[model samples]
Target chain A: MTSSTSRAPVAAEGTRARLIDAALDLFTHCGFAGTSLQMIADQLHVTKAAVYHHFKTRDEILAAVIRPAVEDVKNLIAEASAQRTPTARAERMLTGWVDLALRHRALIGLLQTDPAVKPHLKEEQNASILLDQPRDLLASHLSGPGRQVCAQVALLGIVGAASTPELRELDDETLRDLLLDVGRKILGLRRPRSS
Target chain B: MTSSTSRAPVAAEGTRARLIDAALDLFTHCGFAGTSLQMIADQLHVTKAAVYHHFKTRDEILAAVIRPAVEDVKNLIAEASAQRTPTARAERMLTGWVDLALRHRALIGLLQTDPAVKPHLKEEQNASILLDQPRDLLASHLSGPGRQVCAQVALLGIVGAASTPELRELDDETLRDLLLDVGRKILGLRRPRSS
Candidate 1:
């Protein structure tokens, strides 16, 4: 997904965009349960009704905030799945997933740690299947009993690493490179040679 | 730390143990917010008053259930802190931590993912200091800007890896060795020579 900060102002200039931005800020700092429509409105200097006009519920706002990142992940999974070789798929998935995570670092942390958001992210219904598809695809690339476990941990490490506050100060390119380097080691993949 | 399953029956025999066991099961499966004292009591076929005798509230039961694992971590950190060399400390911390996570696999997942349990685990009062000590110690072992980020992600990877369901089937020796190997690589530590 494109960095929200880098996106053109037009996509982020609308009332809906404003609400999502305020809600994300509040949710990240105060947590999903701690944030309310009134809080979002207060932060935006608007009425709760103004916030409600764009999103009927907090969950709706959360879904909106997470949609872009989720879509990016879905697209990454699809692209990786199309690759014929497991090695090719692993390499592509690693680079794509790391880029997605670095681009949306805060959102990744919230998705992994926030309880209220977690159920929504892992509901096992239509949207939840999207979450599992990438993991299952990763598993297919691995062999042996430990392979699944290694793949899962490697993915967690990369995403968790990208989302760390200390790592946030690193430029995107540096952070992406370090994550890819460490992630390849975790997954037992060979590091790419210099171009 | 020893696995609760491997501990003496005395530690697992009492009404308090039964209550904690039931609570962990419910909390892990249903999410901490979804599980109640009454549900824990129901699981054990015990009266609510009986459950209350051991734990006045759900949070109390969670604290008791988490206490041993936390204590194990505290001891490990203390031992690592006493080591003179960063390499020695990293080695001790990594191996000790992997062992602890394997011993308390299910609990680590619950602590990391359960939002209700999270605040209690992270309370910055007296107990929360214990939580930060190990991380701070880990950080001291690494040098440079990326050190903190690498340390945090490496620890997350080790704990997350230890708790995976697929890895649960691997024997402890195998899991421990794999975790140490991958963990050393994550931290940029040199591989140990033959014993």
Candidate 2:
């Protein structure tokens, strides 16, 4: 994973978020192929040219969803990275990921299934902005090579949990608590040995 | 919630299994939209009309996929119900479900996200295939309602756990063990009742 070494992280601010929020509404309403640049332009109340000024193509907008999922993950990890203890940092990172997954369920589903949108995700490289952020965040709090692999797998498990239909029906509070419970189980962060 | 009160249990077993297996292969390969009834017929080495004779439309075949994900859950519960001990039954059901999910990852994915497939799936009633199955399976074992609900959620959490991309990469033995560990933690099955 390139981590932060390659791209200076893009903050989820301004035109970037406008493009994302617009894309989210359209993609979820219409299947990805059914959505078009013209629709996005109209969604933003901007002309096609203005939409292009921000994102050159539909793929650009598709790539933008990864920004929020990745950024939230990065923020979680970034906060985790600053913690003094490895265990505390991991617990925070794991719990935060579950919370984010539950909160941003639809967006995560878009990024997961739409084949058109997945490649732009730089999960292995810094490009997998969605995955790498949490990965790097969790890696910082761990020591062994195996732990990195576990954290990477655990991150995907968290995404899968929150994104799946079974998890989707539960109310936010229920979902949040279940995910936190699952996260502790995944990390095997035993209570007391826990956060 | 009606556990197929119909005495026949699975109607037309041979034909239904053939249709579902063929659909699973084709749908996973080409996705729901990309496939056609003719392709399913061709794969089965049967005429298209014969395919229709079994399944009325492409939606019917998509509907068939739902059966396995649900039926497996039902079967797991049936077995658990047979066991007299509560902890033993809960263990049997959770462990069995993890195996089933790993064995059928592609179908599970299709049941999950393939937009073309999900709508026709009738997953809401079938959600009981999951929601109610474990509730019954653990009923014999758990004394309290909260613990029973937790047991059911943990079983789905096992379903959730098996759905991960990284876990998908691991061999079944390793994946099963990892989920068992999580199951123990989530259901409070492990000694010491840690996280």
Candidate 3:
């Protein structure tokens, strides 16, 4: 009887995670605005009520869907920030960001470029803080009067191009190599050694 | 009476053009899926029926809205394809593309990164042709086995970064210079002379 009770909550948690996963896939392909709770339910072969039981609204589902990625980015920023030198910090940001972008390619694209998703992202606390932290990290090592804009371009360009459909056909290793190479060039950092 | 009759068609044309413009604005900010006929009509202070008189569906309005941009891109491709040398052709493409991206910054963002809009863009006749021509042009000039991926990164990265909110505050001239500088770097071209 005790084991049955414990398994019940675990089963519910599993279903909730499955729903969030299905919603993320739908949101990636159908878009945040285009996806409906009914569609999410259908994707998981459940009723709309089942979806509502977990997420009260589409926005709630969206928040849950993006929460892990946002946390990952914040964690990335934290680690990169801990580096001693500006160059090391920037490199940490660069390599870490490229991996994050690759790992969450579609979700990153949807979050960055989707108009409907932008406002929701902005609602996350300290969105500006997240933006400024990386800009400052990158700007410290980058040269020229246009360093601010250049930093933004390097960061945005790497993730943006990584998520593009044309590059989708390229394997992750190859894509990672190309992105790191171009990202280093954009930031005026030394190329990765052949060794 | 003759003058009034002659002017009626012109007035209709003016309203039609205004509706398309307003729809484009709505689509850029609200997204293709989030936008509705009523929103477009309300933007122009017209009734839904008036919008229906011109467009049977939101898709029709979207087609009308994006037609000009697609035609402009096609024209740019034609002009670039005419250059005798690959270097000149790539240079023309790079310059023309940056200008085009800057001109239609938000619209390009909506068209490229929005998942809901991808299928619609693919439905355009010869979408693959438009993609291949630029890849071939860029491949010819870019050195390395990853030329294809590099070419796409340069093109997509420029437009994608140009459309980002961070770079939105940078003036067009500044954005253009930054994009051209980075584009040339990615493509392995010589830097422009300061003088």
Candidate 4:
């Protein structure tokens, strides 16, 4: 009985994880608004009740699916925010941001571009605001007119290129270097002297 | 009777224009798959029959809505391709492309990023393939490794910044200059000395 009791939570966790996996695929292809609980259940070869037993609504599943990435971004931003100088902060944020984006390319792409997903991502976890903090910090490092526009477009190039599919074939490391180069140029930063 | 016949065609054209406008707005917000003809009709305060009369399917409406922009891009590419040198070609393509994206910001954004909209943009009008010609031309002008990546990311920045809502507050001319600057820097082009 005790073994069964312990196993129940583990099995439930497994099911939840699988459900999230299916939902992410569906959400990426079908979009958040278009995906339903029944579709997720069918993808899992389970019944609707089983999906409901875990996530009561599609939004609940969305929250669970994106929570890890969002938390990571928040943490990254917090770390980037603590840097002493604009250059250091932008560098840390740019590298960290590129790594996170490459690791979670499709998910990050959906989060950035999906119209239906935005409303569900509350203020603190909002992708736009999360990105804006670092972008604004990066912009502070630039001088002259239209600095904010420069920083914003440069950052978009990084996130956009990382998440975009055309560059997907470039492999993670190569793509990362390319995106970092693009970002630095747009923001008017020189390549590190050591490199 | 002849005047009435001409007026009838003009009125139909007007209705068609209005339906396309409504559909574009709906598709942008609700996503193509998530939106229904009925919802579009409701948005326009018309019967579903009215929408159906104009477009038999949502895809038809989507095609019509984006047709003008697509034609403009194709024409721009043709114009850019006619330039004598790589610099002139890249310059023409870059400037024309940014102007088109800025003019049809939301529509271009949907075309570029929306998962649901891609399949509808078939062989000739494919956004990826259409953008590739210019990117390849620009990359050829660039030397060293990762030249393609540099050009691709630079082009993405121009389109992405124009379409993204965050940078919308910058007047069109300012945004245009900033994006061109970003694109030029990444592509390793110099500021035109005469300017």
lDDT winner: 4
Cα error, residue A33 of model 4, in Å, equals 7.7
lDDT of 4 by residue, B42-114 (tens): 7877667767777889889988988888888878878988888888777777778778879889898676545
**Tens digit of per-residue lDDT, candidate 3, span B39-119:** 987887777777788888988887887787778788988998898888878888888888888887767766654546654
Q: Residue-wise lDDT of candidate 2 within A1-195, one digit each (tens)?
A: 211111233333454677678888788778677788889767766566656666777777776765666667667777887888877777778778878877787886765545444435454324234565566565555554344444654666566556666445566777676656655655667454433
What TM-score would you give candidate 1 relative to the actual structure?
A: 0.80
Total backbone collisions for each predicted model: 0, 6, 0, 0
Name every residue pair that clashes in candidate 2: A70-A130, A121-A128, A122-A127, A122-A128, A123-A128, B86-B141
Per-residue error (Å), model 4, residue A82? 1.4
TM-score of each: 0.80, 0.60, 0.72, 0.74
TM-score of chain B of 4: 0.80
What is the fraction of true interface contacts found in candidate 2? 0.07
Interface RMSD of each: 2.4, 5.8, 4.0, 3.5
TM-scores of chain B alone in all candidate structures, in the order given: 0.75, 0.71, 0.81, 0.80
What would the per-residue lDDT of candidate 1 be over residues A41-155, giving only the tens digit for each residue? 7887766766666788888988889888877987899899998888878877888878887888887777665766765653432332554565566566677766666676677
By summed lDDT, the worst window of 10 consecutive residues in model 3 chain A runs over: A1-10
* True-vs-predicted CA distance for residue A132, candidate 1, Å: 4.4
Q: Which residue runs of candidate 3 sit more than 4 Å off their true CA positions?
A: A1-62, A109-122, A125-132, A192-195, B1-61, B109-122, B125-136, B191-195
Local error of candidate 3 at residue B129 (angstroms) = 8.1
lDDT of 2: 0.63
How much lDDT does each candidate structure score?
0.72, 0.63, 0.74, 0.76
**Worst 10 contiguous positions by lDDT, candidate 1 chain A:** A1-10
